[model samples]
Target: MLFAGIKTDIAVDMEPQLIPLIDSLPSTVPFVGPEALERKRNRAFKARLGANESGFGPAPSVIAAIQSHAGEAWKYADPENFDLKHALAAHLGVAPTNIVVGEGVDTLLGLAVRQYVRESTPVVTSLGAYPTFNFHVAGFGGRLVTVPYGDDREDLEALLAAVKREQAPLVYLSNPDNPMGTWWAAAEIERFIDVLPKDTMLILDEAYGETAPADALPRIDVSRPNVLRMRTFSKAYGLAGMRCGYAVGAEKQILAFDKIRNHFGMNKLTQIAALAALKDQDYLKAVIARIIAGRERMVQIAAKNDLAAIPSATNFVTIDCGRDGSYALAVLNALIDRDVFVRKPMAPGLDRCIRVSVGLDEELDYFEQQLPQALAAVK
Candidate 1:
């Protein structure tokens, strides 16, 4: 009746066709959030130690700023993100021209991918690196070439080799890398950059920079056109929900994002929150200390359970389950069944571990108590 004379099946058949690349891609996403799991289980997690988000909520000043600016939500944010850009410029010792603010690193990655990737253009990344980046590459019709992690860290030399062999226009690396939570020294990273081909653009994701050691990050160099350093307030600043992030690079390279970036994509509240967070360096340092203490506690728990935690420079620790992938998965499921929300890498070499994030004292206490039971259940 809705279609009148036309059959329902005929109407369905007349629906618009998807582009070839989109149609070819499998219907899947990069990560399944804890809320989705909660919905499926009909309950909430007792301990939320997954997704690497800071359980130590944002600075009090940041919250005050958000509350103060709540009324401004009725209006659109400044499309240029002018004030936030200049604030970030002052903080990072770079000019406003070197910065491009976006909804988050994830959105910026998509924009970067679109800028360089055409149909079947090669892209290089670590095999078990950030899946969101891989998702962006696939969506933009780029061929992904991956090198495996070496010694639990991104093999910079191997990544360079793949970039050269594939002549990839774009490459991605997360310092203090995710899932495994390992990092390389700044000097070594600088050496890698020196050898990289000039034509290849590097997306240096430093989302965990604040939680990492002082020497872990390379000094900001806006002179390099090929490197884009992506940072987010989500990790240490506790603003993942706000979704504010920015990338710093050479002037021309940063400006390139304007061609395809969603001008008004950033939420107004996020700008207010990030600006306040930047102004509170004292709070940032205090949170970083707590994260370090939490990391140490996580390591001790793993040891107590006869498991080993990979040394972490990020806010999360990836615990080696000392077994095969299936065994590790069982441990992860056992934790989930106990209302402990945690995650694990799914890639072959990295799947033998489960990742846990730093949380409040009580949450970690819950994790500590339940982890032994989870292991017992798995065994």
Candidate 2:
């Protein structure tokens, strides 16, 4: 007992202060992966459609390449990433100097933001587009100016308007966008690019390019110093686990990546696997055809429940649940509870839809069997 205001002293331990910059940042997890879901549910998902990954898997040649290169894992990957870049350039009909390969589109995005954005630098993207880009912007203390989707598609006109008005140094657009597999034809994207401010750098993500129609992708224009076209082995190449992707741009723009990117981030096996995958065009075409059929099957499944599936140019189809975000969330949770993994959009107006990736026939059958029960549970 103390007579004064202060009590008797004991041992005191002071906690260490975190970096002010880190303290200022909010705690967040950008994406909840399938592995995390499996851990949380304490069971493996019967049908994995939540992540928009290609279920058809990588080409046999690619797998063989990986197997062959498995012994090379002891050595670090080439810092210059020369062979991969050269192969990608040749594949894309560009000079080797015009390409930069990174861990994945996500990592490349972080590098792009780091190279351009500083504290308070303006960046523009759709309100409901890829969240990873927004996450990178926040990480770099960039000001994010978002425009909403128009009829489930990123409004190219509105995005350009925002970039101009804000004089934003960076802008992000995902063709055949995630959470809503909508896309614009190449002509529209080219027009959008033509109107963008010269100083503004555009990160055009074509992660699902392999699944999209040829006309849906704009012709490669490496002369445009302001535009960077990103492609991923994660989607159609079925190499998401390998984390391989590349960005094509003008020589100078591509070189800028070297300034801030992790030089040895690319794995040796991944390089070999992607190169093999690139050479197997027949496998890719077959996978795309299968994806188209799977999308049609998903549409029929939605129609069976009186829901309308949005037209998609990507591997996944966004089905309008004919309700609000809460209803969609309920439906998503119901499906998850049934061991059929799926995902839904969290942004308003677009949140009435649940995005499901193309899985195997058996997986889709599981989804079809569980859909009515999941809907009933939600209702």
Candidate 3:
């Protein structure tokens, strides 16, 4: 009614059409971040514990390195990621040829999916394991075959069986899994790998590997062509703001990534930060100690509230709410309303739990103070 001779139609849609695979996909994010929740409630959270981020912060040396490289931001990062790879190779006891650096674990995961997943290709993973992997698979038009978590752990045998049954090329396993914080011993993982078909690929998402016990990670061997181990600086290194991660695999498999990878995805500053972080193993050990202490505190808080805190090998703890999904969700909502941010599992078997990331002592104190009231409100 307001339009005059000028005439205004705001919506304009004419471009080369989106590919059918991409157009058919649902508009969804892998995770609705804490920032989004803060916006929705129109108030900042007292404790940011929803996302599994390391609040301990990066080492001072890492920060200094980033600062040193700040002026060099105009220069595109080395497309080869040469220096970082060499450093990682020396640190990991592997050759530089085995490494493929990318923006983050998320981007590397997408590249892996692209390499192995195609329209109608079957991919296997635990039912509620990392959602980002599944998001990538769906975007690539792959059929997801998820096995149920058995005893709060990714059922490795079940996953292997499903992979065999479906003849899937790609399978994902998150050691010290998200949402549950459960893990499998490295020996068990090695056995599973030994049995997997040679042609099949395993995408091992080891984003939490830095916080896990040493034995929890299998030895790095670039001889295995079918396995890709992905790790990131975002977790224990506390460089979530810097987009950097790398994968270790056989040389041939690693070289294949060069085909489709974003050549300049690595930020110059991020490379410097990651290099500094790798050199500062002492700082990493201190952070891990603090994370373990914080986890113990979280467990104590949960127990005080009469909830069962699951044993965690990661930087986060999943507290069992001793009820159904609805009740757990109610508790989650109550926490949100009380200015505490936390998340819960939505998969069938894992739904009776809420996940909380390790944060600073004062931040966790806010949670400790608010949790009882939230539980009572839910009750």
- Best-fitting candidate, scored by lDDT: 1
Return the number of clashes found in candidate 2. 0
User: Relative to the true structure, how large is the alpha-carbon lDDT of every model?
Assistant: 0.95, 0.91, 0.93
Clash totals in order? 0, 0, 0
Report the poorest 10 consecutive residues by lDDT, candidate 2: 7-16
Each candidate: RMSD: 2.7, 5.2, 4.4
Q: Name the regions of candidate 1 deviating beyond 4 angstroms.
A: 1-12
lDDT of 1 by residue, 1-379 (tens): 3767875465555768899989999999799999999999999999999899999999999999999899899988899999999999999999999999999999999999999998899999998999999999999999999999998899999999999999999999999899799999999999989999999999999999999999999999999999999999999999999999999999999999999899988898998899999999999999999999999999999999999999999999999999989999999999999999999988888999999999999999999999999999989
Off by over 4 Å in 3: 1-15
Error of 2 at 32 (Å): 1.1
Local accuracy of candidate 2 as per-residue lDDT tens digits, 1-379: 5587887565467566886655778888777888999999899999999998888999999999888889999999998888888888888899999999999999999999999998899999998888888888988889999999999999999999999899999999989788789999999999999999999999999999988888999999999999999999999889999999899999999998888888878899998998899999999999999999999999999999999999998889999999899999999999999998899888899999899999899999999999999999988
Candidate 1's TM-score:
0.97
Residue 163 of candidate 3: its Cα lDDT?
A: 96
Q: How close to the true structure is residue 195 of candidate 1, measured as C-alpha lDDT?
A: 95
Task: Provide the TM-score for each candidate, comma-separated.
Answer: 0.97, 0.95, 0.95
Best by TM-score: 1
**Which scores greater on TM-score, model 1 or model 3?**
1
Q: Per-residue lDDT of 96-193 in model 3, one digit per residue for the tens? A: 99999999999999999999999999999999988989999999999999999999999999999999999999999999798799888899889989
